[model samples]
Target: MTSKIKGLKHIIYDLSRINEWWLISAGFVLFAFLPYTFMHHGRVLDIEMFRILFTDPAVYIALLIVFSAQIFLFASNDYFDRDVDALDPGKRVRNPVCDGRVTLAGVRALLIVTAIIPLIASLYFGLLAFLFSALAMFIFYYYTAPPLRFKNKVFLDVLSHGLFVNTFPYFFCLVALMDFTVGTVFLLFAIMMRSTMAQMLQEIRDYHIDSQVEKNTVVVLGQKRAIWVVFSVYIVLFTVTTCLMLSYELFGWGIPMYYSIILILAISYIPIFRKLLKAKDYNREIERLWMGQGRTNRWQVAQYFASFSIYFILVIFLIITGYS
Candidate 1:
């Protein structure tokens, strides 16, 4: 009985993956709040929505589904990458299953429990939300799982990552809660393009290690191509920013000084983009660039979401104060 209790404790902790859960939760909040901001921007933003959200069982349920999805994703990633991780000294020490702290059967049970809850909870949102949830879970599960593991397929790999990781989570939460429009689709497009760039950065970050492996299976597009792809996506993002400002009354920014803020963030990436494009020595430049950046590739993704969140909050404050 004591051993069973200990096993249960470990399973709970391992599956929580708390740091990643919180980070993704931040994205969820950012995405979920977008519709609220747009819908109430010119009008006095309601404090009542906050109260209702706090009291709403559905909000809690959605959060639980997201939490479960994170657990399933990261834990399953560890399980599927166990062999690869076991090859690395650091990862082998960190992975519970790989380190013998958890068994394969324990992992199987963890996967099943975590996977089922989201599908069940999503039903409360409606059949469309349920279908979206299923698709999200399927992509999450298969990204690293066997038989058409999408993680190893070059263009499809980053595309899938963008879809399941960024846009779908944002899309479903909005679909579950509010009426959406073309502006919403544009927001989703921006989110996806940024997500793909981040995943591309991850590919660049992991490329050296993956290439070092004796029998290489890395399908990340070569770093040179990825750099150009990121640049291309960067252009699309600028276009989206323009369209967003033109098409929507963002937070009652009738005169969108907010566009400047986005442009500031967008411009910061350009120095590196130009450097990578012009670099004469590819290998040395990439090593130096990745080493110098210091921030995680995913940091940029969170950064964008966070900026939008602040924009949302700022507008609400303005409206509440009659500044808008």
Candidate 2:
């Protein structure tokens, strides 16, 4: 009985290491459902848009494809970054492949399964969906693959990160709505800019391991300069978004909820900006306090809080405005 219990415990632990549960959960939230929910509320007054977005098989299939591609991309990153991740204090705790809880072969098999799902989803959707899905796949492949590996390059790393994290989500939302309005395009660009800023900051947390790996933008640019880059981009984004919000209000198209989201994002950036200002040095001390540890935690918390608040406020506004 004791041996059996131990065996069961081991099984459970191994299952946890697979981390598919977390990935699927995130995919469902970020890709599969959130966009549709946002559009359903934002464009609720337009019955035709609602019907096209919610009832269309193409949109659903596109979401499926996006979800699958994300999973594969994540798994591939783990596969290639296993060595670097093993050395990363932040990554070591949960890195399945490096911890020996998950095998390369297993991850490869999972990637194959993930890749196949998108292809099947594309078949059910339309040619447009298929083409978009292929583009996402290519981006993921180039991100990890050699020669043109954008992950190792400075500008390309940021661009690729923006594309996968921001562009893909925006595209997913637009495709769901089946209508590409100016408002939708602006929202997409805002999301992309925000994601780019966040990703640049993230490099600070992984600086040590990334430096050892001799790749990643933070390593190439050095810490102080990297932080400056992060700050500059976000500052620009904050300015542009603020102006857009003001314009939205001036045009009488602004919902209170949109303003609320803008305010929240603005507030979230204040501390980050302060950190950038106070950063006098980029050695281990600054890296430890700002980059190595605290900044990542703060940024992650702020990111989730801001994103959730935006979605929640929008939904509430839709309901209150009698759109839903």
Estimate, for each residue in 1-324, the C-alpha lDDT of model 1 and write its tens digit.
Answer: 998888887677865557544576756655576446545554333676565556667667877777788788877887887887777565576678888778889989889998999999999989988888888889988888888777776567788888777555566777777646554555666678777876776566566655665221233456677678778888988766875665546554322443334555576566667777887665455545543333234545555566667777776676566662
- Please state every model's RMSD to the true fold in angstroms: 5.0, 5.5
Clashing pairs in 2: none
lDDT of 1: 0.68
Global fold similarity of model 2 (TM-score):
0.73
Which residue pairs overlap in candidate 1's backbone? none
Candidate 1 segments whose C-alpha is farther than 4 A from its true place: 1-10, 37-42, 89-94, 209-220, 246-264, 268-324
Over 43-133, each residue of candidate 2 has an lDDT whose tens digit, in order, gives 4446665566577665566556666666677677767767877886667655566777666667777778877888667756456766776
Q: Per-model C-alpha lDDT, please?
A: 0.68, 0.63
* TM-scores for the candidates: 0.75, 0.73
Candidate 2 lowest-lDDT run of ten: 9-18
